[model samples]
Target chain A: MPEQLADTVDPANWTCPAPLRDQPVVVMGHGGGGALSAELMEQVFAPAYGNAVLTGLADSAVLELGSARLAFSTDSYVVRPLFFPGGSLGDLAVNGTVNDLAMSGATPAYLSAAFILEEGVELTVVDRIARAMGAAAEAAGVTVATGDTKVVETGHGDGVYVTTAGVGLVPDGVDIRPQRARPGDAVIVSGPIGLHGVAIMSVREGLEFGVEVSSDTAPLADLVAAVLAVTPDVHVLRDPTRGGLAASLNEIARASGTGVRLRERAIPVPDAVANACGFLGLDPLYVANEGRLVAFVPPAAAEEILAAMRAHPQGGGAALIGECVAEHPGMVVVSTGLGGTRVVDLPLGEQLPRIC
Target chain B: MPEQLADTVDPANWTCPAPLRDQPVVVMGHGGGGALSAELMEQVFAPAYGNAVLTGLADSAVLELGSARLAFSTDSYVVRPLFFPGGSLGDLAVNGTVNDLAMSGATPAYLSAAFILEEGVELTVVDRIARAMGAAAEAAGVTVATGDTKVVETGHGDGVYVTTAGVGLVPDGVDIRPQRARPGDAVIVSGPIGLHGVAIMSVREGLEFGVEVSSDTAPLADLVAAVLAVTPDVHVLRDPTRGGLAASLNEIARASGTGVRLRERAIPVPDAVANACGFLGLDPLYVANEGRLVAFVPPAAAEEILAAMRAHPQGGGAALIGECVAEHPGMVVVSTGLGGTRVVDLPLGEQLPRIC
Candidate 1:
């Protein structure tokens, strides 16, 4: 295993950049689920869609209605080929919903799946999907409680598109929000990033490098529970999906109205992912990570939380990637590997073949 | 208005033989959101996906998680042209989600939207879509609480595909389910079917008839609430989306394990919709209806429910179209205008140009 990069990088090498203030209409990078998506949400959606439930910025939203406190979230998985290395559409659909609920500090209980299948899709393919769904539900300890199926003609639909909605219960007294990050908080990543995007891209582009890079699509309920148990002070928790680490950190920064200072040499990057990204002119920071997360915790409890997270099977590589800072409010600055520094701004346009 | 067709027409008046039921995969009919989509769900999905929440067959599913009672549902809207004569993608997405929750007798409270935008999509189109979404949310009295934006390359995605997930609150004792239909129950339709499908088709094909057909893309929360107030015994509530009325009835029959008998003359079809169907060689029963619903209620409360439904703007054309029967378990039979009897089985394939 690669050594943890968290403890070695020096903070003095970092250079901070000015905050990004301009916002654009729906751009390709917004889908990266990274910095771009975060910027769009902060600048456009958050302002227009301001509300207690939305402002929380949890993986899934925790809603309080009457006597009920429920966690609700929706995700649309449009991964091409439906099947890819390490997982299929079924697994992604189920786990994605469960993970969203988990992010809201809830135990995912039920999921509703809606499928838009292209006409002429083979029964065998659908059967495989169904089996995968059943298995995924079992693995996540949630039931496929309800579903809707719509079939479109061949050209109108891709082979299959799955949209899942999940609901869970948030335990009382556990307050988690993106804006809750404090200046003295420590930022830790659950695992290495860029695995999922790399996995998907390899298959789509038919890249033939050895060192198998499978999509890291796994349920994070246990890992989340472990960290939450150590400290509900775990203020901000976001999965680095679509747009990877850069997007997630930027979102946390803006949500808390603060800045993030990162030790570039302290961040973990798999050799295979780094090599692939280098060859493709892609930034690993802006790539997608299905089974990874960034958590902001109170400075005092950071070590305890890190140890607890690392103890969990899914969080074995947990590391402190950065720290919440007070100086450059709502911006992320990183120290380069070569002792230089740069601003990690939100990506502007499309980053195709990055959601592997 | 043209006179309703009799139950028994002369043999010479028969224009086409009954549709074949041997389709191996979905066709345009299935997408019609009418009977064909229903048949596919019943014959394939239902059997393969036998689960408690799914078997209930309600418009929206009422789920019990820990101490919370929540309604969770998901829907994908793949309507062609994205923008139609009466509404746009945003409106359909909002109403579609709201109606799904309303069907479960749940008052919609929050929604999450996920967009898959093609790379080259114009900014103007996206702006219009966003505006439409905001307006639709306001009209439905629901908020777009959370959202995700993803951009696929130009060729990979159709302009834009939207998936909306909604959460609503179900009253303490209300237990609306599709399988709850019993003998001596009356079937009521909110309004005419096939309008949405026909409207979309008209725009796509550039067909201009004397009376233009526009989609009835309206929310049905008020109608649902009014009817539920009168009788929580509303056994089954469904929106005849892709497979239209024929599919909705068939699904109810199969789920309730009872037979459904309908009078062709009692069913309401707008003159313009009927003309469109005739010109296109389609059966109105198998077309889609976006802003309509089919409700099964106890015979004693049918009149009251119909009156209450008609009071709502979206349900002004509400009418009693059928009744549950003890015979022909798992089947739906209709009396043709020609005075001949035919089995209205679930459509075996797609019915193109439908969104319900």
Candidate 2:
């Protein structure tokens, strides 16, 4: 990091918004989807572009545009290695934004891709990435409609960074938002966790576990559509990405002002992922996953939704991992298999950066 | 430049798409929004992701999404020196996307901002930029609805690069596009040209041309609305941005299969801008302007629309500088004062890189 840039920032000039007054310069944590990232959104972006829809701060903003209900979302892919074990940055870029819209009960239709290319990256590499993106978009049933490209001087950027913005049509009569997670809701997770972060780390650090761990990067839009088919009001849905499951749970609890109680043993973590996390001294609960989703459904509809999700190929390992409770509002507590309970706080930063 | 990255590019791997068979690597000209930029879009991107709306290659893709007419556009701003004389990258990002939608005759509504921040950028600099963005969005009557942030490793990124994607509602009965320009249509300019490019060159090179030239980087949506009010049948509206007036004119001529003839004395060029360009061996017609636009109007309604544009403060310097002709289709010719005519070809690349 450049010390000169940090030296130029005066804390007093920030006007010190309450609870986040000390961050005089941006740290890697500010980009992690954890408490620091939330604070950045709340203190900086939320106030600057203050609007009801924006302040809602959902995975996707659901807008009602002139007789059309739309879900809009965006994601930037900055993974270290352009190509990973199970997926490249291309597929991740497509799946990440597509899942964000799916979480809002929308059928994603179109996307805008903007690329920032470093000056001397190989043209063949870009071509390969573009072809992967094309194939991914075809699989997801969306079009890469509009794009812009900018080239930065060499060494001033990583090879290429892609930012994708998407628009989709939200299903009628379905209103899903973070604030709708009530105390009587059942929280179910689709498949295993921690695969994506582990996969990226394996490639980046050149460390291999006994088994090759591949990223679980896939589109969950169809799975979401299945759940919505069973019941329109699914309460809250989120893909555990960047800061992972723990951070996602904490965000929903805070947004709904309710408590989330997770049965630790019920949460499914693949043996490979768990072993890798153990060896690296990282918590599986704080590791990211690209294709998995956590949904909060009313007690009466939980069974049907879980059944629907399990029937889908992407969610064959779906499990009822937890429930929302009224005991400790705005907190998440994990019930240990050892007959003890522990608070699961949001991580200060990601255990691994650029794991998305 | 990283020679290793360049060395990996095999020209044979590209398959040598017709017309663009030569360039093996992405050059700065590919992003210049001129012929090379268009060719890159036509050859590389269009073939990789083939779709109807994308192939149109309009300023903004007009879409019919669930009974709502929408215009989707995106732009990436990599302007060096983050802060310029009259504007920063913040407002440039906001205005650039807004103007793109305005060219499609859309009421600019919402924007998505994604920022790639270098690891050590100062918080104060980011704060100031964010504040300017907020003010610009307010002025343009649009909201920054969603955002994403990523951090690159130090030395692998510029201070910051912003990419904005915007969605707006296109007004009914307005079919403004590049292909709409036709023979005998009057070509009108909204304001003085070349100020933005000169302003950045002045700061980047530390040179002065006897007079300080400030960038005209304000949002032009209001001026567009004023023009559309006079006549909904305006042929085409385009903001002369990256490659300036000459490039935009050539693009329209090629798209509409017509020729453009401009009276040299009628084109508006600020004295300072002309002097600066002359000193730097740059053509005033090819230098960029942020807050300026060119319109193609039917001869019958040209006078009323020109009057309407001149009435707005942003368009106070509006003038009728040229006309579309059937002769020499796909070219732009300027008539000299001595009754001689010379053709103005699209530039191979930008005179100034990262000038926004």
Report per-candidate TM-score of chain A alone.
Answer: 0.87, 0.93
Model 2, A37-124: lDDT tens per residue? 7767777777777666666868888876777888888888888799999999989989999999998989998898888887767777
Considering summed lDDT, which 10 consecutive residues are worst modelled in model 2 chain A?
A1-10
Q: What is the C-alpha lDDT of each candidate?
A: 0.74, 0.84
lDDT of candidate 2 over B183-291, digit per residue (tens) = 9999999989999999999999999999888999989889989998888898888888888897888788877888899999999999999899879878899888889
Among all windows of ten consecutive residues in candidate 2 chain B, which has the lowest summed lDDT? B1-10
Task: List ranges where model 2 is wrong by over 4 Å.
Answer: A1-23, B1-23
**What tens digits encode model 1's per-residue C-alpha lDDT throughout A1-356?**
00111323322232211222232234455565644455556554555554555656667777776676777788877787678888988788888878878877788888877777777777567667777887888887888876777666566566777778887787777777778887888989988878888888888888955687888898888788898888776788788776578767766776788889889877888898898888888888877777787888888899998899888889999899889899777777898888877777644433663252
Q: Candidate 2, TM-score vs. the true structure?
A: 0.94
Give me candidate 2's interface root-mean-square deviation: 1.2
* Candidate 2: residue A267 lDDT (0-100): 97
Output the lDDT of residue A342, model 1: 72
